[model samples]
Target: MNEDEILARIRDIFQDNFGIEPSKVTPEAHLYEDLDLDSIDAVDLAIKLQEMTGRRIKPEEFKTVRTVGDVIGAVESLLAA
Candidate 1:
């Protein structure tokens, strides 16, 4: 899928799983600082993304995911793979 589609899915995941407002989930939004997500929340996000993509996410692949844009890029790469 495209980046916009991946972003939409990320927004949905953030909203449904983390109770975050969709409007707050933007490309530049930091997962921890902006979204107030903790490390456990990061793990939860990874699990949720795995469920959505039906693919296992490597820890290394997610290591650099700090922003919503990074998450979108990761999901896009996973989907493409």
Candidate 2:
């Protein structure tokens, strides 16, 4: 899928799992500072992303994700792989 589609799926994941509004899930939004996601929330997000992509999320890769755009990039790379 393309970046927009990946972003949409991530938006849905954020909305469904964290009660975050779709409008708030922008590319520049910081996963922790902007979205109020803690480590546990990050783990939850990774899980949801894994479920969506049907692929296991590597901890090292996930460790580098800090923003919504980063997550989208990670998903894109994961899907491509």
RMSD for all candidates, in order, please.
0.7, 0.6
User: How close is every model to the real structure, measured as TM-score?
Assistant: 0.95, 0.96
Write one digit per residue (lDDT tens) for candidate 2, span 1-81.
898988898898999899999999999999999999999999999999999899999999999999999999899888889
Model 1 C-alpha RMSD vs. true structure (Å) is 0.7
Pairs of residues clashing in candidate 1: none
lDDT of 2: 0.94
Q: Give lDDT: candidate 1, residue 9.
A: 89
How many clashes does the backbone of model 1 have?
A: 0
